[model samples]
Target: MTTDSKRKGIRLPRPLAIFVWAYMVWNLLPVVAAMAFSFNATRSRSQWQGFSTQWWSGTPLSLFDNEEYTAALKHSLELAAMTTVISTVLGTLLALVVTRIRGVAKRPVNFILMIPIVTPELILAVGLYLSLTFITVWPFSVVELGTPAQVVGQVTYTVGFVVVIIRGRIAVLGDGLEAAARDLGAGPIAALVLVLFRLLMPAVLVGAMISFAFSIDNFVITQYLSSDSSTVSIPMYLYTNARGGNTTPALNALATVLVVTTLLAVALASLLYRWATRRESVASDVTGTVALSA
Candidate 1:
């Protein structure tokens, strides 16, 4: 224990600590194995011959050079970008509406919005696929089984998560700032953009990060909605070739790329969140000091 922890008498239970470590190891072992074998000199995933960067670079079968792997990665990124933008905007608006609305209807509306999150991915995918295939109505008729469909499917599920996150932030923030902004002669839209939205920026970034992460790793929806080879994503590519007899360490390298991409995005989001919150704190402190002086 550290000095602070010791002083506070905060000793972690021995068995619980061991169990947590063990659980982490168990969950991470396969991912670690995959990443390690991606650098193997040979093609065998089970047996690591030696350390080499062949799968990551140099050859045609390498992650970046390989057409299939590159295409999949690109598609995954495109989907993630689209889904994140759309879901964040829509979810933020929905959360704002949900939080502001009063009375008995609010509970039902909130529950309705949460339906997509609670629905199973496979079922959701199947429903979207069937609807897009069979329903020839205006909007559904215009949409097809490709990137557009993938975006729609991803956004549907991802919006719920964004709503949940933004709503939690809204709950903590309350309506005081917005009310004050109104009292200061700011219009409703101005109050939203200048006061409330500034405070909610951290939550928006978090929602975008979650949406991107979910979209990038999404398999069932992407798979069901794919029209052809061009629409295949990284997750789809990995599923197709991971157990193949002719598969190489290149597959592992691709998986590593996906993992690294997600980690980088998460790191970036965390930094942004910290920056935003720090600004909010500083602004609040300044306002408090000014009020006290007055």
Candidate 2:
């Protein structure tokens, strides 16, 4: 054992530590290389040139200056935003309903909810694509393939994720707080809004972030549902160019932007969740102390 381990009486097996480090390096090296290439002075992805912002903003071919790339980025952000909102709201409500309503139907409802989670994305994409294109069901049929279709497809998949997060949080928090609120003279609606919703804010934020990340990174559904160049998302655009063997460092720049955006979102959510939980804990402790003193 190392001196620290001998002193503290704690040791991670050296072999396990080595394996974990190897796994992290193996997984992250390619991503780091890609991000580094975003700043490359040349178009070569394999060879590193001196750092430059040409691909990001300095030149006309840059992500900010290029019309197609800019449009694709905008489309991705807009779609992610719309999907996040819709999925978070709908998923939260569905989770609440599923958790509160107890009976034989619960298992079936849960199974139905999880179908999208376990089903293959390609299958879901094809199904949605066909339904949108061929099925004429009045108002629903009026929705065309493009950003609207992309948003719908993303929300369909991401709602299940949001449901899972919020439901898990609900399971942890339990129904005790809501019951207490009701016993203290709050109506059901008031209890839900003032007590349950507050407790669920962290999970709601996490679910929204997951929805946003998934919507932004999604490829198959967006590709299948997209109508034309105008509807192309960042992933679709990247795939087309990369497959064409004419991809520039601009693609790397775009990918870096996506990675950084997602990282920032997750970091923010984690901070908020910590803050919320800490505040709730403090409040609970204070309440308990007050009751004890009384």
Candidate 3:
């Protein structure tokens, strides 16, 4: 009964497998319908008349120019890029600082950063909106928020998630690698360049991608902080179009693009990380064998 298994002996439970399939179907049903409807010839999303790609082609063009899908896409991309750069820089610094901390202060700092992550988005959005009010601080008019301020506000909440993710990676990367490099006469910066940066690169990249996706899909925070119609992102565009007795096929098309892009990037990142880990594991095993033989 205890025979060797070539497949690593890992197996999903029957009930668990059933549940996973059911869950996937439930979650993907709407997405699947949207994608299918994106290609439908009819204007109505409910009826499956026939297949056409007009939504994909000439999207937001002559027929759909009023939707503002093109402008909204540009806005979302710009906002996502800004959020990614700011969050990645801030989060990486947080991870680096966390790695250097070895005392009681670490827990409190981490808790404070993580508190925003666990807080409900609705509550956070409302709080951010209230805080932006013209209520006087020291009798002077408070700094009024615009699109840039909205991005900053959202990034504040986003940095917390990024920090937690990168911190976990940094924690796993113990001090031994840096110690070895230093013992070999490298300076602190040199040691970090030679040891720490290479090891934590994958985690940092993954964290950045996650932050980018979150920033792009963010609705509640952006909704609360949003000021001008010009600041409208793709999510906000989709929201208003979905409501207000308006239904555009371009929204479906945009959803398809978002889902595909997100999935592709995530899949590529996962594969890269797995391949790197596998190579490292194999190299370590080979080195261990050589050392044992010696």
Candidate 4:
């Protein structure tokens, strides 16, 4: 029998497919509802009166027209941008070092790097909060509880994610390419920069996108580190109004924007990863052809 015929004989039950579909709808239905409500003409999120852009940009009560909402959104974007750049750079360097170095200290170094990844966010937030408050050192003293502290806190948790991603990429690429570059008379730094880093660009981009998403969605750390109203992110603002039950549909509009932005970042990362992998394959094929010809 053909592979398709054999698989058809052993196919999953109809109920299983129905269950999976149901589960997806259960998970995504709320998000779809929220996005839909953002454009509702009426104030009630529970009941959609009619389709309108009032919450988004229709008038005085729209998200764009509201100063507080606009400010919070701007602050979130800034924090995400700063966190992505810093964490990606530091994390990429750490990954390269960890992958190259070999010693008794490697395990300890790796364990230290992973602590934030598995630790509770609340604990990490509190620890960061206390350090910034009591640690009267040169940089710590200067780092007051505000946007600066928020950025640092976000970076602390996010750098590990970047490290994990780039490290996985490094593990896959192996040492063969770097060794070949060195054999071609390239110095260590030159090989790393020109060969390894170029190949690792997709993973780096993925890490940056992940860091940006995490930073933008972070609430606990931002809340603990925020000094004033100026440092309030979208999540913090949403929490404040949401708890009070006085929020308008404009809040939904704001949430939709956040959802769309995060989805876009993730989509872009996937596209870039595919492109990078394709380019790498082409380069490898060319190199192999040259070697065979020689």
Candidate 5:
């Protein structure tokens, strides 16, 4: 008779396999396709004529040379960078208060935060337009509701997501460490700064990065709120070109870049998380070993 210890285990659970398959087909496959087509030379979409890098440098980017593409790219980069910083700061603050405080403001702040993330972008866009348009009656105080408006609007949407992310991490953040720091002749603020803030730094970085990605791709609010061509973001530019029946090889090129950048950031975030957890695990193991040795 065969020993039970020698028997092979069953394959992975069916549900996990199915989920992996579904996700690969629906989300991963299309991205892979676009990436592949970035190098494909075809006048028409979906028909791979040949492989070429013409799409990338095929057209020289210049102000007179339709640098709208270049301009949009730069604009988006700036916006994303700004949005990331502001949202991270605001979100972390919001998360800290909401999680640590107890009052009417906690629920209200959370509710308001959820509204931006959960509500449809289209509805938010239209609502913003109405609010901005109508609120401006006086010449001096009447703020010009435009690209600057869109920047603020995008921030409104993105900061909420950042809040949710930071809050999730904050919930799991143990106060025991901070308490001990305080016990060790440290002030409350000092304990929090040295212990709590340092501990949550990874979450803060990841949240800001995630918010940056989202803000980079936001189109609906940007389109509705942006008044002129000065602040046209890459997403808005792509939407216009695609919808207006203007097909270009560069579209695939740009898409490929976006996909790669997104994947890279996601990979980086995953790596950071793994590294952080691994460090914690190693420290725990060392502590356990020393205790056992003692």
Candidate 6:
């Protein structure tokens, strides 16, 4: 049977499908409602006062026009970008090194790397807060509780995710490609850059996107490390203003910006991943064909 026909034949029960849809609606309904209200002409978050873009752009209280909200959004994007780059690079290197370690050291090194993944975010934040405050060494002293500390805390939290994603890709790929590159007279670093890194591009892209998403959504670490208004992120801003009596749909507009940006980053990364994987598959098939011909 055709794959589509087979899938239809094995379709889930009506009750299961209903439950799945219900669960999705249960979770997404509120989010959809909130987003819908972002365009409300009035300040009421609950009562829809007709659609308007004033919250987004027109007035002084709008998302872009308001200095405080604009600053927070800008800071959030900056933090996410910095954290994504730093975490992806560091995590990719750590994953490669950890994957190659021999006998006794491998297990311990891997366990250490995974500690941040399993640790609670609050705990990590608190630890970072203490470390940045008390540690008086050159590096620690230089890192005050602000953007620098926020970036460090976020990188510490996000690097684990990158390591996990890249290591899984590395495991699937194995060392054959790198070995082949070396056999072709490429140096170690050359083989790694040209062969392994090229193959790992999809995973790296995914890791960076995930890091960006997490950093944007992260509240506890960012809050703990924030020095003042300058370090306020979207999540922190949302938390502070979400329940205020004077709050407007502008808050929701800010939230929509965060959600849209994250979704765009993920969607773009997914597209790049698909394209990279397709190219890798084509290259592998062509290489195999040439080898067989030889």
Error of 5 at 74 (Å): 1.0
Tens-digit lDDT track for model 6 on 157-228?
Answer: 999999999999999999998999999999999999999998899999999999998999899999999999
lDDT (0 to 1) per candidate: 0.92, 0.89, 0.76, 0.92, 0.74, 0.92
Stretches of model 4 off by over 4 angstroms after superposition = 1-13, 280-294
Residue range 62-157, candidate 2, lDDT tens digits: 889999999999999999999999999999999999997778999999999998899999999999998999999975698799988998899999
RMSD to true structure for each model, in Å: 3.8, 4.5, 3.5, 4.2, 5.0, 3.4
Model 1 segments more than 4 A misplaced:
1-10, 279-294
Q: List the residue pairs that clash in candidate 1.
A: none
Summarize candidate 3's per-residue lDDT along 38-136 as a digit string, tens digits.
888867777888988787666443224544776677777787889888998898888788767778998898788787799998898787777766556
Q: Hey, what RMSD does candidate 5 come out at?
A: 5.0
Give the per-residue lDDT of model 1 (tens digit) for 1-294: 233343487567999989989999999999999999999999899997989999998999898889999999999999999999999999999999998889999989989998888999999999999999999998999999999999999999899999999999898899999999999999999999999998899999999998998899989999999999999999999999888999999999999988988887788888888887887677876776678677
- Separately for all candidates shown, the number of backbone clashes (residues 3 or more apart, or on different chains) is 0, 0, 0, 0, 0, 0
How close is every model to the real structure, measured as TM-score? 0.91, 0.90, 0.87, 0.91, 0.83, 0.92
lDDT (Cα, 0-100) at 42 in candidate 1: 92
Candidate 5 lDDT tens digits, 214-293: 87888888888887888888888777776455566677666665666666666776677677667776786677667867
Model 3 accuracy (lDDT, Cα)? 0.76
- Sequence-dependent TM-score of model 3: 0.87
Best by TM-score: 6
